[model samples]
Target: MSGTTLLINLAGSIALLLWGTHMISSALLRGFGTQLRQWLGQNLTNRWMALACGIGITGVLQSSTAVSLMATSFTAAGTLSLAPALAVMLGANIGSTLVVQLLSFDISIVTPLVLLVGFIVFRLRDDSRFESLGCALIGLGLMLLALRMLGATLGDVEGSAIFQLLMRSLDGELLLALLVATVLAWVCHSSVAVVLLIASLAGAGLLSPSTSMALVLGVNIGGALPSLVNAGSSVARRLPLGNFLVRLSGVLMLLPWVPLLAQPQLLGQLPPALLVVGVHSAFSLVLALLFIGLTAPLAALLTRLLPEPERVVDPGMPLYLDESGLEVANIGLANAAREALRMADMLSSMLSRVLQLLRTSEQANADEVRRIDQSLDLLSAAIRAYLADIGKEGISDQDADRSQEILMFVINLEHAGDILSTSLAQLAARRLRRGEHFSAFELGTLYPLHREVLESLSLAVTVFLREDLPTAHQLVNRKEVVRRLEAMASREHFRTLREDKSAWAESGDIFQRLLRDYRRVHHHIAALAYPALERAGERDINGGLVGDGLADAPDTIDRKEPEQCAS
Candidate 1:
């Protein structure tokens, strides 16, 4: 083959290899992501267990980067401690090499059979699990086929003058080879693919043993870069940074010994393919053994290096929404859900301060409430945009529903915040300007109602997060309690107004307005229950179950309740 044609074929094989790796990673994530995360979270009791868990998970997923991201997110959320998280990263490095070891052998004979079964299983439309498995199988087949094609393509150019010159140059400049391989791995986002490509080059007699070993070390270093760059917070970045440090240290220790280790008496007795993969595998294994016990101290070092930033309140910017997560539906949905919960917390805080504002009419308190409300608005917009950016193509039905559910919850929260900042805050300001306070009786009536609203807010958050049917029932029931309390307070105000018309008129007006706004806020909060109840097969707004005959009828619950409450 001509040099140009050889280059094209080589590039195509490499691209195929990268694409196959992505398919396997994405498919596994879609199929069993929740279980993987839960398992990773539950088993992180100590460093040894965390190490085993990481090895098992990365072996299954065949992508250390995926494991790294998972560990980083857990660390960020405080689900996994820094020490255990470091251990997981160490195991992940070794797990990645295990995949390389398996792929380095001659398994092209099974490629056709794997692809056939994968295609058949993938065509089974009713079972998502089977479909995901099939996709993973197909990805595996493609990777094997690509490796075969790579060997063939390189063999055609193995004797070319230009290829020989390039290989000779890399043999002289080991650092240059390392740099090129590092860029390839970083850009491809798969060290496995890069190492496999190097193994193929070595097997094809296109690269010296030292050059292949140097490339392997480069891939090890490059594998850790993507997670560090994409991490969302300082805490999240630590695991990846620590992993990078470990790999860099290993490479530094081994760089000067490459020629010695690659000699015929040492590692060169094995076949070229085995030599390349053995070095890769042994390097990671040594690192894991050396650093596994030191994970705690390493974690401490990382913590000092990437210390948590002081908690500056940037309320308008989202703290949990991760843009990189949008590439994976599950991760994106998770990010949106976390941000929605944050919005709920902000709403709860605003509600708690509303009563204080009414009592004291303090300008500072009112400003804080307004600021939180503005932050809510910004977060609402950010979440909506983030969810919208998650591409619909390839997302499962469940994830799409979850995305919608989070969007609805945040919208309700934003509406409730508006009631606090706009309607209630203004009433408090009016009372302050007039140099009047709520009467003792008015405060007495309002206090219980405010307390109930706060309780209901808490319940609403619970329902939003858990979607528990019983809790949904209870939240919907609280709506009636809030309504009755508001009515009773209004009646009492009217009675006081009748006794002294001119004396009670202004305060009565403000009191009734406060009750109306509070009830409206409660309405938005209560709206959270309807969707949950509906999902549980309750057809009525009051959380009553109905038969299938009634299921098709227009929703008795106001799907647009939050927007109505806002209006």
Candidate 2:
């Protein structure tokens, strides 16, 4: 083969390999990404367990980069700590070497057969799981095929002058070899692919033992680059950077003596292909053993290197709306739900302040309520914009419903915040200014109503998070009780007004408005439960209660029959 053709062939084969690796990662993630993330979250209790989890997940996914990205995001989200994440990265590095070990053996004969089966399954089965399985199979077949092509392209030019010169430059200068290998792995985004390529070259006698070992070390360092580049926070970058530091330290410490080991005595006694993979695995094993016991100090050093930012006193932004998850529908939905939960929590805070304002008026509490309302507005806008950015093409039907539910929940929460900031907050400010305190009876009624609304908001948020059906039913029923309480409170206020004109003039208007605003806020809270109720097929016609097909009383807190209100 001519030099130009050989270069083109090699480039094309590498591209094919990259495409295959991407296909495998994306397919596995689409099918089981939630479970994998859950496993990482549930299992990473300590360094060793985290290391084991990292190894297992990487082994199953066949991509350390994927594992690293996950650990980084979790740490960014505060779900996984830096120390455990670092342990996982070490395990992932070791897990990645398994791919190289498997690829070293001859399995090219099954490539065509796997391709045929994958094509048939992908064409015939329309299920997402089966489709993903087929895509993974096809990707595996293509990866094997790309490896074969790479070997063929290099084998043809083994004795060419250009090839000899290229070999000579890397042979004498291990540092240059290390740089080349690092760049190749970084660009390809797969250390396994790059290491396998090195092993192939070593196997074909186009590279020496020491040169291959240097390249392997470079590949390990390069493997850490993608996660670092992709990380958006200090917490996310710390673990990957630590992993890179460990690998770099190991490689540099061993660099001077790699030539000594390659002197046909220590490591050179093994076959060339085994030597490459064995060295790769051994280096990772050594790193794992050394760093596994030092995770505490390592974590402390990383903390000192990358300190956490000071916590905001009054956070006004979305905490979990990660843009990276937009391409993955389930992950994006989970992020949206979390942001929605934050909004609900803010609403609860506002309601609590409203209750406190009713009992004891304070300028600071009123000011805090206003600030929280502003925060709620900002968060609502962020979540709406985030949901808009998520592409609808890939979202499953359930996720589409979830997206709509999140949008509706945030909208209702925003409306509820407006009720507090405008209606309730102004009333409290007026009361504080005029030195008007609610009557003892009025306070008694308002306290229960406020407490119920706060509790319902919490439950609605829970339903949004977990979609718990029974809890949702109880929330819907509680709305009716709040209505009755409001109506009874209104009746007592009017009865007092009739009995004494003094009470009516002193507290009548504030009493009526308070009841109206609290009931309105409750309405918004109750509305949040509707989506869950509808999904469970338990929505009532007029009452909006979650029960079998019985029409409810007209949805009104307007004074019920006096006995019914009392009930």
Candidate 1 lDDT tens digits, 1-567: 787897788788867866776677678667766565566567786788988888886876567876786677768866578898888888898899887777566666788988898899999787878888899889878866776776676557656787667766898578998887787677656787678777877887878888889989999988898888888888888989999999999999999999898888988778888888889889998999999889989989999999999988777788777545776899888888888888888887786676667668588878889999999999999999989978645688788777778888989889989999998888877887788887777777777667667777788888888888777777777777777777777887787788875774666688789889988988988888777777676766654645322112121222221221121
- Candidate 2 clashes between residue pairs 3 or more apart in a chain or in different chains: none
Give candidate 2's error at residue 241 in angstroms: 1.4
How far does residue 397 in candidate 1 sit from its true spot (Å)?
28
TM-score of 2: 0.57
Range of the 10 consecutive residues with the lowest summed lDDT in candidate 2: 558-567
Per-candidate TM vs. native? 0.58, 0.57
lDDT, candidates in the order shown = 0.79, 0.79
lDDT of 2 by residue, 109-143 (tens): 77899889888878876788788878978987787
Full-model lDDT, candidate 1: 0.79
Q: How does candidate 2 score on lDDT? A: 0.79
Q: Which stretches of candidate 2 lie above 4 Å from their native place?
A: 1-34, 44-81, 109-160, 196-208, 268-274, 308-567
